[model samples]
Target: MLRTDEILSTIQMLHAEHLDVRTVTMGVNIQDCASADVEAMCRKLRHKLTSRASRLVETCDRVGGKYGLKVTNKRLAISPVAHLLSGHDLNAAVAVAKTLDQAAAEVRVDLIGGFSALVHKGISSGDKVVIDALPAVLSQTQRLCASVNAASRRAGINMDAVRLLGEQIKAIAEATADRQGFGAAKLVVFANIPEDNPFMAGAYLGDGEPEVVINVGVSGPGVVSSALKRRLELEPNLTLGELAEEIKLTAFRVTRAGELIGREVATELGIPFGIVDLSLAPTPEIGDSVGEILQLLGLDAIGAPGSTAAVALLNDAVKKGGAFASSSVGGLSGAFIPVSEDAALADAATRGHLTLEKLEAMTSVCSVGLDMIAIPGDTPAETIAAIMADELAIGVINNKTTAVRLIPVPGKKAGDRVDFGGLFGSAPVMPVRNPGASSRFVRFGGRIPAPIQSLSN
Candidate 1:
């Protein structure tokens, strides 16, 4: 099973393309950390997390250095704390979030997800607690992130949960207004959310997953963009299909590198390896932008006329390449178009080249939806629900995962700038027309039926 030349070639391709493993997320099921007594539960939660994830970030860095690859974030995901704190009050639920944040800091991980609730059908007592605590928990916590799954292909959309989350989002923004509504940055509302996703603001240790597992998120926007550039220069008349094939091949190599590193790290830590999430997650950096990749695909700008088709091609090629690379590939492994997180996207939004509607259109073909988008503080909650409903409808109809992380900058208007700093970046608050008039539609609280695709045997 040894091939020296093949290994060397893989390394060369990685180095040349500027590809690297984006994150090594360890999912630690903390359902067992729950107890009838609050103090006992906190103790169990701390002990389990510290024991399982004590060396996660450190080991990831060590492994990355050893392979001459960079591991950008080492993260942890736990079971939905809402379910664990069902009998507890909102204060108790917030305490659980605090424990998660402290544990994450002790482990030195960048972020800890799973302050979550899955209320696609109906809300539970724990779900209410978590939802109510979101304003405080998000504003108070440092590294903890939260996600709420309000819709699924099988269960349809929960209009009640959607409406509530819309209000909760506003509250969260108001609670952290002084910090640019940074609390909203840590929360995401999703449709058809993936369980084993290694990405933040959404990743959660699903009930079906093992006690502890390693999930890798591999990113390669730069790699694919560079490959396309070289191919375009070499064959000026190459078809779009040929260009996509080249991108797929490059993604295959990148996925291979991720799988190899993930397995090694899992084996060394004596834990089960979950899957390789081959999402082309971009950063605020120049060359690493997914919007830049779209520009390379001949688009005049990121949100131009042919932008949706270009995204469709890029997402399809990335999935095909990742699927070919490893049988263990899972999670939302497609192109992410977060406006604030990608420099080019932020520029486009600031220059009025990209709008909220165009971003929604692109999310239909891409992985995540309306990510890191900032809007006016006065944008009505009903408008947020309408936005979430539109994206979730796309996910339900297509049977894909889509999510929203909208930041409503307090006291800020469309032209105002909100800086979240670091990986979240900064963006001009985009305008949303007719921010009212959706409340009546949202108030008819019932589930949106699943699409025909869910009838599969």
Candidate 2:
């Protein structure tokens, strides 16, 4: 259906700008793997995951090679273990987590999410157990990822659940202190968590999803940045609207490429295609970064004065383009600004050009909130809670999905480096000036009432 010129442009963009499908995530519901006997349940869970995902990574890689596209990650997301752990003890939950970890390793997937709980309203017994087991489970396992939905637009923010999660996050941090609380890197606390996300540590198979499905996350920050740079070079007086249109057209091509790859993978794997997550996920690579896109928008540095506006424009344009390209687009399909993952952002943090406050401001328009950020090791639990509360408040008020994945590197002071290695690049431990000052405010814990707009429905 593409014209000759458009097709050539797409090929040029892909080759020059590092455009590629970011992730091919398989969602597998594990509720049916539950059983009265803990051992039986764990065995079933392990077997099912191993059988289903054994060829996932291989298939994705093979397909990527055929199209000359790089599939960055192959992952699995299962039903929240909390619902399946109802009436089971903490030991049982850990056992299930071990099964998940083993299965992930056996199948050679990078990460497996859904050590999760949906407690936006209140915590059930199962939710409490899964939360309590997090510190031990995450510290003990390697590939399993966890998330908790502590707030939602319709149900309001559960301050009690948020408080508990804050404490749990601290415990997880302390437990993995040797790795600078890198265990917490595998966990996310969210507001209005999406069910079909293919990225982690936020991806989880929600209760309403089917038995098995394939969800794709397509990334093209480099592609967008290249387009913006070209436009600016040609027309210095290009309006913001014109810049956005350029991004939209580039995003449209990227989304189409992802849809083609994802559907092909799904068909080969014999699973229903879920959605395409048209998120501009970044990496530590030089040209493949969301922060570079911000820089291309004329900011000398990523967190400068105009950074948030640039991110807002980029996010909106990417969403608009993806929506036009595919009716099945879902997840946090916008620009992601994970601190450690983007080299420019990391450099800005090291140079003191970016701060936690600026990152928080940028999250208002970005896909994920406060992602892969490392703070001072001695940061108080109350401050972490306040940070999360602020981010969740934004999502609740705006009726969008937002999450916090803060890493409190134990024993590391401000400006210290915490190296996570691989795609979770190293981050300088940023200072948190006022740590425990928010304790009194957080102690008066109850539901933060829903925003006025939420009541209209």
Candidate 3:
């Protein structure tokens, strides 16, 4: 049983901090909708989404209104579309993506994830269909998002899939060149992608999850930064240990607030509540930035020498706090440094303070890797694959969830600004240091063997 007073106490702290649930994603298993006939499959898919997610927005609003905690985005995640795409053609893949878009629009969700393929070990026929259709599907759809898992801790990295995705990603970008490669923004490449993440461009109903569930994404970069600042004002000479404690406590309270609302919304919809992802996901808003938190931690610049250590500390502290707050804490529960989505981080990129290499190093210790970064449009596909290989190598070796969401902005050069607007924000394109130097390396494509660490038994 939940105590309203205790819950209200949690909500009070969130209200004061001006914190809100970043997303409330309903995960639905749609594999049962698969059919040999493409038309029938799409029909079933649309009906299933509409039926399952029709009341998601309404329920979230009512539940949030009860505590004055706004649910910023309502969305959905479905079982990987690849499983249903088997025996289907590339055109069928586009049709399915279009159906997903229509369903999302009908249900009032911001975006829907799971037009995805899990090719960590090998690419199946269905996976090929999803990859091949990216150019057309992404260009035509509005609210559809896609992801490809090309590497994993247990299976090592699939260089073949990574290389293929590099080529396909560029095609998707060119297909949407009018929008500054925005289509690529909707697709992410991952190593060890989470099953129940409520965030976009990667969330999906992975195997072993419930048929229907509600997952929550609650990010409070502003709240965490404010808490640290207050602590600093009181004890101007506080040690890093003490400041980390402040961040941990702030994360605990924030997790509690997010989980309570998630459970209430789940109950209203008569579905099981899933995990609360307590990532410090930043926004373009001035005060809401993970980089600013780094600055508060005494870094004069965002990407200074000790930036990786600072990110390591923040990620560890955030996870510890969320874990202590709820046993249901799951997903990527740490600090995210998506460049364009974070105002301070974007400024640092523009001023040459943050480079792609520095971002990769930080991602080794941060929650997600090299997210929302814009690169020169003319970058070679081999270079893109090499960049992904580096980032995924971190996740594969460290056994953490790391992903890449790079936007190859067409006709844009290094240091050129791109305004994606809204939560997507904007960033000056960061130069890829060695454009085609790694072609020989990526061309020798094969599975990079799993580390000895995978023999955990």
What is each predicted model's overall lDDT from 0 to 1? 0.90, 0.91, 0.93
Q: Residue by residue across 162-247, what tens digits does model 3's lDDT show?
A: 99999988899999999999999999999999999999989999999999999999999989988888889989999999988999
Count of backbone clashes, every candidate in sequence: 0, 0, 0
Instruction: Please tell me which model should have the higher lDDT, number 1 or number 2.
Output: 2
Question: Could you tell me the lDDT of residue 78 within candidate 3?
Answer: 94
TM-score of each: 0.96, 0.96, 0.97
TM-score, predicted candidate 3 vs. hidden true structure: 0.97
Residue 215 of model 2 has an lDDT of 97
lDDT of 1 by residue, 17-119 (tens): 6688888999998888888788788888999999999878778888888988888889999989987888899778877888889999998888999999999
Best by lDDT: 3
lDDT of 2 by residue, 195-278 (tens): 999999999998778899999999988888888888899999988899999999988989999999999999999999999999
- Rank all candidate structures by their TM-score, best first, as comma-separated numbers: 3, 2, 1
- Candidate 1 structure lDDT: 0.90
* Selected candidate, larger lDDT, 2 vs 3: 3
Q: What ranking of all candidate models by lDDT puts the best one first?
A: 3, 2, 1
